[model samples]
Target: MPEEIIDLNSIVSGRQPINSSETPKEVTFDRVHSILYGNSSTKLIYDNAQKYFTKKFDQTYPHTSLQRDLFISIIQKVHPSLKVQFVVEIGSFTGNSASIMGKVLKESYPGSFLLCIDTWLGDLAMWINKAVWEHLSVSEDGRPTVYYQFLTNIIKQNLTTMVLPASMTSIIGARFLQTYRFYPQVIYLDSAHEQGETLIELSLYWNLLRPGGILFGDDWGWSSVRCDLKKFSYMKNLTIEQAGNTWILKKPVN
Candidate 1:
């Protein structure tokens, strides 16, 4: 079999190059708010993330911070089965979220996995926004090289045993949805923010959740994300819990 081709340099540079058209005069309101309100621990992580990845962003990716806390909460609150299997994470950015989940999984289930799925590519919207992409390194196929760096960082953090990288996919890829049919105990969805992609992720992954499993999505109240999740509000037997930009959904164990 051919070795999987990866761009090590791109993985280290988590942001794509910014062009003149992409640069802005100053950071946005969200950026300032994030900086002001960020917890000390979160700020430290963000600082290290910027330095480790050499990437800058217009707005703070608070999803990464929230995801970490929520993931830890889930593990501590829910007792795992002796046969603890898998925790699925869609969109592993810099491995922050996965790393946190892995910590709990490592203690609960010696060899259980944190299976992450992402294309790691900056889409047209990402490029057009000219934000994080400017510092991200992408392969010829468009996957970010920072993915490898994320893996390496997690390993150094002692999370290697609990993390697994699955096949990559664009946020809107139907094939990816079909692939998600392999049910997981917990699924964390945080892919693209476009309406179409978010809807597809919800539809496809919702069913792949095993009984008693939980599904959570980031970017809940954000316009692009909120619009899509709102469509499911009227669905029978489904209730969503809102927390900042995170939305939690459960697959009842009936």
Candidate 2:
């Protein structure tokens, strides 16, 4: 196996990144409300999200994948097992949502683990939208290297035991799971919002999801995302549901 191939379990056994002793940086909000708010369409969506985050998430910043209550409720009400033991989270930016999820699974679904895969690099929109890029954790070398901070967040939450970090592309992460014969009961897609990329990711990860598993993601407000999900749902004959900014699709149990 190559160095990039992550041993899913071993990653949580210990964090192998540099400066292990360094204090974890506390994540702050984009209080200025920057993150692509310049675009009229996205601004409208962001403002809408701002309202929900303020009400439900305690006035937290709107840059993360949230809705803790919604996620747990779906598992409890919809999923047959009423528990999620395995989760694969694509695009964990600084582990904000993963921390919430890790904590939830730890308390509600004991013995569960979340494999968080990411490139630790901001998406293209971030680079194009300077305000968005400003929020990322950049290395001294000027690279958007948020991976270490992601580990720190996991450690701070005491989730290293249940939150496995895999720093790589979504495709490689899927391959890693396949190599281990790993199958996830839940797959979270938050990586790319581009229609083409989103479709590819949805199709690629669908194979890794167990029957009756849930495939969900954020950014439903983005036209591209909505279009891609609708197209994918039509192609697969899967029914997609949405509540707030999150969307979900369940694989039929044959």
Candidate 3:
């Protein structure tokens, strides 16, 4: 009997061909690269931003360094040539992801822009979480300052020019885009995680995606997210690919 050995480097480079019976289970280099060095660049920006925000405003951000990197990777994959004009993010919590995307778009696609749609009112969970309320600034009338922090973060990143802030709920924002006939190359959904809301968002914004565009989201492991994505894929007859914790569905080109 001959010994069957797997060449690690060959697998990583996709150079060596595998026999049918010896086919590897997964051959996604993006996932592998993410596991190895995904945080290399984004982490620095996140850490610096975190320190600055904490020192200046005594505040902390919501999204993690991993999420920031993943978002960038998705944007890169969608616009490999850096020719995208518009990218939309459904939830722009604290503006971390939006700032990152804004920087990437500005550098890669000079005229590209990011449209972030969020009410900035911490979700139900955040509203109930005392920790969230403690870090938030209050207005003269006593309303928690969510949108202000988001704006401050964007400004800190110097992304005001590339990132457009749309202060509104997901549904209203999506409808506005639809009514305005705005089509984006990439649509990222990270807002409501509930199954029903997630499904609605998937449906509503899916249409706003240009043909051959990408509609991706985070929290793929969440039961609601996973189930809804599968159902949506089935309904649309599209295939879903998992990149890190994100699930992506590329619209068919007509």
Candidate 4:
């Protein structure tokens, strides 16, 4: 009897191929950075951020230690390569981290970009945390949102070209990309910190990540994150690499 060989390319496609550059590469960072800080001053965006926070929320700009550490850890993990990089960020809040990643893609990995997937609705944790809630904006009629602020941040830094936005749930976004056969070199998950949701997201995005690509994110200190990740790691038979509060998982190169 002859063995049947599978022809994967025979699968149905939803859309025509969209022209894009090749796969991913490495990164870097500096002061007054990531992207689109405008042309006036190096500190223009920072100043604007502070002013915006003070005027709107009556608080300081919210750059935290977790973000700083995440940036550094990502820089360390993604090596310098000439290949074009594709990144998908599942939870973009106010676009600070996305902008930082945009800069990394723009400067270090040329022709690269980051796509942000989020509903812009506050997660359960964010809804419960007062400090996080302070960052959310509401329409006069009463629709709470942080999406506009995220868009503004991306535009303010001129990162629109490098940082694309998709206002949707992570699962839906993942399935959409799967239809296009879109595979990112890096996938960062930071949505709802629930065990079930985290596990499901990790599995969904893991399939969309190209081999050797890294899936990492912050909130490693969250019990839900740690527990779900442990389950995910065990299931995938992949070791977890930790740097500060950031957790990393690399898809096998083969």
Candidate 5:
């Protein structure tokens, strides 16, 4: 029998493709063109992705309806290059909005958090709507249970790390603002679409935002929310833009 000889040069050049029986050599690899999801250009979209990923359990909260599309688009416009540090959200229904915002921040600033405030008690409609009573068996007395379940869902999603839960009116005090050491970069007012409540939410966070920070709300087309936002814009000399069911109020960039 003749002895077989291997061509070493061909093996090194990959001119001779290795068979399945051949073991490949291991070598170190370099990381080129790394992608940061929530970078300056894509932070808002990144946040929307997080919300979509966790949207299944969000049904309990009153859906934003037409406002959802506005949120998706708005998130896109909010370039991550702005480097807004904190986000404050009023009326964190089932925490869906907060979770979405938190996801965006996580991509750019992993340690950032969203402050979520709500009573968790169902809105006034919950007490008056016959549909809620018939479907979810959510009588006025059962609202607390429904609210509890919403928070439970928030926790199960591992959102507690990014969501700071607070009761209604709790975010107004000086202590709450002092905790951040800096003003919030974005403020969302979606608490109550009712006239009084909407006005209050706006008034509360009006001056609390940093000069370049933004304030937006859902149900912008609604009579109550719209009126309040219009007045707010005129009074503050700020411009309010409506996209779908949401309104955006931008504080002048300083």
Candidate 6:
């Protein structure tokens, strides 16, 4: 059989047809705030980062503005008082999410830093299964230049100082953090969504989060992601919460 063709533009434009019968509710700032804070009275930060990403990069990120607000809220809740904060993001594709979070950190906590970890080469699954190879950046030698794009996006947003890049796999990045004894206040896992890989990441990065910190991931609706998160939460004796397409696991304050 011929290879199945996935429309990159359709997915980016949110025009992709749903393959499942169940339709998730639309994610809004109020909905996300309710789930994360249990109340909607708290105002969320409104930034131009999303619009900047859309206009400059022309890529559709899976994360939304509401989700980004939730992230900032969690960060503020965990580390109230504007101290230096450290955030780790396992997947920093095109720097959209990173840009949003970085902008928040820069404005709220002047000395805060964000560590964006990614292979920076397009995922093999996207290349082989989704046939999105052509959408990725290319070098003179025909290699993917995604890392360059990520760097450029951050620099363009004037976030190079706040958002640092780790051009490596998630496992390697986690190991480097461990070796350095670097504990982050918030860790976002949006890398591998396979059940086993997600489990490994949770196990590996869970201890790296400080007390009262948070560990969250995107793609909560995926079977592999949800199943593994449920199992992981059960094993860790933590309650999992949903905000839009994101699943959050907060470390206890003990």
CA deviation > 4 Å runs, candidate 6: 1-67, 79-84, 129-132, 140-142
Residue pairs in collision within model 3: none
Which run of 10 residues does model 1 get worst, by summed lDDT?
1-10
Instruction: List model 3 lDDT by residue over 1-254, tens digit each.
Output: 11123221221232232233452323122222233236424432223434433324322665433355666666666634424677888887766667767777777776667878887766665667776655445466776666666766776777755676677788887766654455788888888678867877887788767776789888887899998787777766778999777788877767
What does the lDDT read for residue 195 in candidate 1?
Answer: 75
Please provide TM-scores, in order, for all candidate models, with all chains considered together.
0.64, 0.73, 0.71, 0.73, 0.65, 0.71
Off by over 4 Å in 2: 1-61, 81-83
Per-residue error (Å), model 1, residue 193: 1.8
lDDT per residue (tens digit) for residues 96-179 in model 4: 678777876677766677878888886775677777776767566666657667766776677755676677799888866765
Off by over 4 Å in 1: 1-63, 76-84, 123-125, 129-131, 139-143, 170-181
- Displacement of the residue 172 alpha carbon in candidate 2, Å: 1.4
lDDT of 1 by residue, 1-254 (tens): 11123221222233333332443323222232243335433452323444434432222333364555667665443334314466678877666677777777787666467767877664455566556564345666765666555655565676644575544663333233333233466788877777766765676566555667777877776787777676654443477787676888766776
Q: What is the TM-score of candidate 6?
A: 0.71
Judge candidate 4 at residue 43 and give its lDDT.
46
- Lowest summed lDDT across 10 adjacent residues in model 5 is found at 27-36
Report lDDT (Cα) of residue 15, candidate 5.
Answer: 28
RMSD of each: 16.4, 14.1, 16.5, 8.1, 23.0, 16.5
Q: Give one digit per residue, the lDDT tens place, for model 6 in 1-254.
A: 11123221222232232322444333233443343334435432123234322324434544333355787666765744324367889988778788888888888776677878888776655567534554465556767766656766776777755677667788777766654456787888888587777877887788777788888878887899898787777666889978778788878878
